[model samples]
Target: MSIIAVVGDCTTTTALALAAGWPSGHDAVILEADRTGGSLAAWLGTPASPSLSTIVANSPALGNSPSTAWSAVDAMVRHAPSGTRFIAAPVRSRAASRALSEAGGTLFPLLAQLYEPTIIADIGSYAVADAPSVLFSLASSIVVCHRQDAASAGAATVRLERLAELVQFLATFGVPLTVALIGDRPFGPDEVGQFLTADGQAEIVMHSLPVDDLTAAVFAGRTGVSERRLARLPLIREASALARQVAPAETDRAPDSSRIDQLGSSR
Candidate 1:
């Protein structure tokens, strides 16, 4: 399995879109590991039980093996009406923080060992001080999402530098970093790339998703919108393309030994 962590200033919709638009025949599970709390339970109408909090509570019982830990995680997985699997996080920020703090040390390493399903972790904002750095060390790829507006771009410039520093420190050089631009406002892909490159993020790859408020609203839990209709929207279409571009190849699934060793030694 591959772990793709989606981090951003505000990327809930981007994460949801990627999971919803994942390529056919490859199972993708969205893990709500956001330390700031989560919205998937409410948006997808799933129960709060069998959540990140639940997983954290049960982690001590998980055997040392990755497969065993994965089995326990699988037991807590919930599905949306659209059939996408996800593990929810607590709605309360304090509870979410505590769960992540308690479970992160053991949870991320176990997740790194799994080799079956693709786990797309919605890691909330990388800008937060309490952001889970361990997940970044283990992810196969990291997608950073931001709006195309000036304010969002400005924030992303700063956060991307911080992310670059973290990745360098973790020695996760083999992991791919992608910048997904949400909406085409005053800035397009070229402009976004230029500014980011000027800010020393030239290594990051860029992708864009169109503004589709109607479809995005449905993802945010608006009732009466059909999934079939959403599939044809620009947002979903771009998300599918983005997924195809970022999904790790089968040959690349195994973690790089040197990188892992470096990460372990540094920790």
Candidate 2:
């Protein structure tokens, strides 16, 4: 089973959407731990309520019914259009941060039980060692999304530095981290990756999500056009290739692998 943990900003939700749409019925879930903008809900079609919040608040009493929990999960799943399943975090990422701080590596395996062999987490800036958001230790693969310019590049560099500092922290917990760099279309994979690494970056196992029409599909909530185009694009292909690196078999892959659009490199 591959547990993909994403650590980045709110745009991470869009990344998850892309991951979901990579193929039809990608058996994946999103933990909308980013509580600031309700970005996950925005991506999930308009939600009826903060039911994820309610569930986290009431889980102890409700026996944490997977059926009921799954109800909320289902609502968001509808917005997905792709075959991905998701659950926003208990509250904001900060709250989940607390849970992570207290629990160590507990939430992922339990959540893993409810899904398929592959799991993708839209983790935020919480990859740090002990301040507490989420742990990189739980990830089979850790993808960090960032831009290429100095500001974003600088941030990515810091994150890479932090990820290194905390390697042992996660290794102790059984997490294997492989870092990737994501950028928009204006930036080429080689260009962004090279600039970032020019200064001797963290041996970044890096690649990028080049800007293209697919992002428009995500925003308009009708990505079929972009999805079709991207099904052949290098960004998606590289993502698939990386995904397969960690998880090879079809069952090991997200549902997107089954799609006709998947590029050879992706598989």
Candidate 3:
């Protein structure tokens, strides 16, 4: 039950689209937690009925208990054509935006606790505000998606600095932070990661998603490509790789007998 927060310096919709294609073995949900708004409803051509706005507006009646709050969030979830479930952002009214500001910190912390499904949240860009920064404390993994070219790379560095600042306060939890490069370039993931890692700018896991316009269109609901065909695309393959890298199985790790014995003794 890990919460993987996908955020960026620029638009993260494409990154979210790629993430939505991850090979989900468990129940997975994409949450549009961007305080500004979410475009998933429009992209998937689904009505914004059960959205974040709906949950926030109903929060008052739902009571302050974690169960009630989670119930409200659960009810708002809608499944996409791609088999990805999501809670959309507000589109019609600005009230939902306000709701996110007022209660986002509290509500999302509860969702992060649900262990059944892996919550891949499209948190948009990082912000200094509590609404967006709260996830830095709760998320098991934080992927800062950014463009890889020269210009955007500079901006990405700035964004990473901001993210580092936020994570510093929560470092004791050992949250895994990653920088996911989106777009094509001569630089490989390791090369870019090395440059960023130099000078201890910030240590981060590096991942890449090649620019595949066709696959992007399919994820954006712009094409009529079948799911099987879409699955074969380079975009999907890279996303799958990134997903596996970000969340590998516990069995893939070597056993730490000493740590196990220590835990046993403590118990």
Candidate 4:
């Protein structure tokens, strides 16, 4: 159904939490599209092959249709012990970056075709110059995750400004952009909003995820928390609520002509 790109400073863990907490009746897959690198294979103990690199290597052989693209991607999907399905990126930074660069023009467009399972792409730490712009252009929604601290907020502001510029260039003003604040701190959503909007960036929706290190550790494959217990954690509960809010309903699906045309031209 929908492709939600999660980006910002240190968003891999936050993105994982969102994917794991997706509401019931909806099937979601985490696509580790981090340009820098990915740690899911090592973190979740999943296999290293049949990854993004595999998809990139095999892209030319696949048809341009959505069904064909979905099939190529589905074959590489792997499941973690926690029951989350994900497509891992290469572990090494150079390999990962190279794969993305080689496939940047096509990988996300192929991903855009699928409409069955919702995709939550963990696009860690968006860079204005080198980051793939097509990913943001085609995304149904974008969530910028950051901590409450001053440093993280400052970094998020910079990314948001870059995103504002990209959105303007692509003319994708309809796409929803959200700022998700991680953990508790002295400042709240209002203060965070003020900080983000002070620079006159695009309008952004605000959200928060609780601090639950134990549950996060479980997600990292560092703990033995049971599924039932994990679901009850504050972090999971809030993430589920957030997922419900951001993910579009099945009936609401409709092709945005401008975005589709933009994708064609970008290619």
Candidate 5:
């Protein structure tokens, strides 16, 4: 029903894992649209075949029927150990990236028409005319994740300014741009929102996820602990809150947050 695109300096994988954990009955898939290369498959230990490259190559044929396109997408999809269905980014296929840039106008519209409920795309960072930029325009909401330190905030400020320019009427185009602050920073969510509004001239919504290195390690697949290990962490809590806001209909019937501990312990 909606597509939430997560980008900027934060850990995209962590966001995807949290979103996947949401109790949305409707299927949720993470589509990695990194412009340079795909690292999601390597991080999750999934093969990179049947990835964005394959999807782009098959775009012509996929346009014929919605069923056919969905089928094609399904073929490239992989289920992460955490139970999230994903299509990894293409590996070193500059050609594929170029193709995505050229035909994204046609490709993403079909993807939106075919997929329902939610599609969370991991767009590493904003690059002008990149593959993710095309999808950015079509997304229902954009979540820009950045750390709180001075350097990061400064970069984020510049990026947000550029993003506002890229998507005119971003505040009123039915596409809400949200900033998700990750890690410790001098400014709180409110202050950061105010700053973005003042400096970038973009009315922004903001949310923050506390810095938890261990929990982040688990989400990135660098740590061997089960994802349930993060059940009590604030990172997960904030993620659940954001997920609920973006896709409440999906989690409306879901159990309370405490169920996370139960689910974790059960396995």
Candidate 6:
């Protein structure tokens, strides 16, 4: 049940995942399914598993005729660790999460059942009406990946509505969401506050992942999990705690928001 969905732009999520100690050589994991292949794949240097194109090519495995060609999809997930796996909807931005219907909500949790402690899903940057909602429907916590600019956060804020509706609709699945913001540069909470206006508000929750030198080290294939864990200071620790709180539980209820210290870093 220690599963989290890292949503939004993949441009910086690889760094965010490493900062959070995913696949951290512990009871943690980071699973990626990006068709162009995300920064995580390059960071981890793992091999190519099946992709959206792979599933698209094999659509008949899930449903009707082969000639129908990608009208339907079979979400392709691959076991990356004993208790962690990677799944990405290989279609273009809008089509990314479409595999939810093909795999059902069971796809993520099924891997979680096998992978156990933690699962980080890298959902690339596309918050369309269809697939992102489906992925959010499956997430225990969603790391809303944004850049450190005013615009990306602005986009993230607007996208929060779709997230709210999806969470409400997925009641039968059971799991509230915690939202974490990931950016490439450093920005204080006050600066972030400016963009997070009421129009951008969504009820699930939010957190920040700090950008740092060691962060770059980890993603550059320089450090291992044991080497980098707890190195980003408070931001890293808070992220791990939030991941735990959201991952293990499945219900409309989320961990108490007030008690959770929203963590970040000093410039």
Best-matching candidate per TM-score: 1
266, model 5: CA deviation in Å? 14
Q: Tell me the spans in candidate 5 whose CA falls farther than 4 Å from its real position.
A: 93-96, 115-117, 127-132, 150-174, 199-201, 248-267
> Which residue ranges in model 6 land beyond 4 Å of their true spot?
10-28, 35-39, 50-117, 129-133, 150-175, 182-187, 190-201, 223-238, 249-267
Q: Order of candidates by TM-score, top first?
A: 1, 4, 5, 3, 2, 6
**Maximum-lDDT candidate:** 1
lDDT of 3 by residue, 69-88 (tens): 66767777886654557788
lDDT of each: 0.71, 0.48, 0.61, 0.69, 0.64, 0.44
List of clashing residue pairs for candidate 3: none
Instruction: Give the lDDT of residue 39 in candidate 4.
Output: 90
- Residue range 106-224, candidate 2, lDDT tens digits: 33434443545355666665444335444354456656555334357556566545544544343344444444555544445565445545555234455455544454344435434
The TM-score measured for candidate 2 stands at 0.61
Residues 1-267, candidate 1: write the lDDT tens digits. 688988764577877777766655566788887877888888876777777888888887788998888888888889666566788889988998888777678876877887778888888876534544667777888887776455675665664467545434333445777878776665677876665666453467889888788767777767665445555668777887787777767533322223212212222
TM-score (all chains, Cα) for each model: 0.83, 0.61, 0.76, 0.81, 0.80, 0.52
lDDT of 6 by residue, 1-267 (tens): 345665554334442433243322333344454433444434444454465445544544543332222223223444332222344344343444354444444344344333344556665555445334444555655555544554565565555455444434433345554445555334454444443434443344556655444544544455334422434355445555555445444322332221111111110
* Candidate 5 global TM-score: 0.80
Q: Is candidate 4 or candidate 5 better by TM-score?
A: 4
Candidates, ranked, lDDT: 1, 4, 5, 3, 2, 6
Against the true structure, candidate 4 reaches a TM-score of: 0.81
